[model samples]
Target: MDVTTPPASGDGPGTAPADFTAAASPGTVTLAWTAPATGRETAEYELYVNGRPTTVIQFGAGAVPSGRVEHRLTVAEPTGTAWAVKLRARLPDGNWGSFSAERRITLVA
Candidate 1:
């Protein structure tokens, strides 16, 4: 899959997260990112895999910006595969933030 660079700052819904990371093991890949200090309570996170929107992860009402968020994907491929993953924060107003830096991971069999 193609790797997409994050958009310029102040271009999208909000600021993107920093220090994005990903780890892969067997059939699963885990993605994590530092929360942004947008001053809005994040309601959810949109996860993109291979440039496609794959899932939405919801946050608690009292979620803190200093905390990190993580999501694990159970890939369906038997021989493993390479994936480009990114994340965007969703505010309580239902607006999405700029995508975090993309992280690439290769799941091994």
Candidate 2:
């Protein structure tokens, strides 16, 4: 996980994480993004894989610009498979921001 560099910050209230990226390695995929302004206010990040709600990322979601986040997952699917990913954050106070622009990655060895 790399947080030393800041990605794009919030465009405005209710905005999604900034500069979301996904990178594929032999058997794992790494996802990273810059948190939103309200990230620290109590939010759960939802990871979507292939357009389905996959899991809730335990890492903080709205950590501001300096709280860039990175998560890696092991891939069990076959190589050359296509992985489409998206992210959105849900706040305990009833705020579900928009989903981050989708990122695509092809699995490789």
Candidate 3:
């Protein structure tokens, strides 16, 4: 695991998009995010759940200029009351930007 540099403060081109949605089952949640404004240099995105390396999804060839890019994630076969899901950008240069605000969803019984 690589340590990422702290994002710029005061909202000076350093804010990530917020993703949200409710899951139908326990330990599951929906995810979405706007691409990083400053981290356009990123190559791929690393989706994380509860601070762990969860998934690596590839970004298209086009440069991630700015503004939001939304994505959806599902926890297969959830097994708990709720789940925490987060998404982050991974630059092609091996630098990771900031992460989206974590979201919590309850599982259906």
Q: How would you encode candidate 2's per-residue C-alpha lDDT over 11-99 as one tens digit per residue?
A: 55656877899999999999998776673543468899899999987644454225677778988888999989999876556677789
Among all windows of 10 consecutive residues in model 1, the one with the lowest summed lDDT is: 8-17
- Per-candidate Cα lDDT values, in order, are 0.77, 0.79, 0.59
Return the top candidate by lDDT: 2
Clashing pairs in 3: 25-107, 26-107, 34-68, 34-69, 35-69, 42-91, 43-91, 43-92
Error of 3 at 12 (Å): 3.6
Candidate 1 C-alpha lDDT tens digits along 62-108: 76445676767787776657788888887555678789999888887
Q: What is the lDDT of candidate 3?
A: 0.59
**Each model's TM-score?**
0.74, 0.75, 0.59
Best-to-worst ranking by lDDT? 2, 1, 3
Q: Rank the candidates by TM-score, best first.
A: 2, 1, 3
Q: Over the stretch 83-109, how does candidate 3's per-residue lDDT look in tens digits?
A: 576667764456776777777765554
Steric overlap count per candidate: 0, 2, 8
Q: In model 1, which regions exceed 4 Å deviation?
A: 1-14, 60-66
Residue 27 lDDT in model 2?
96
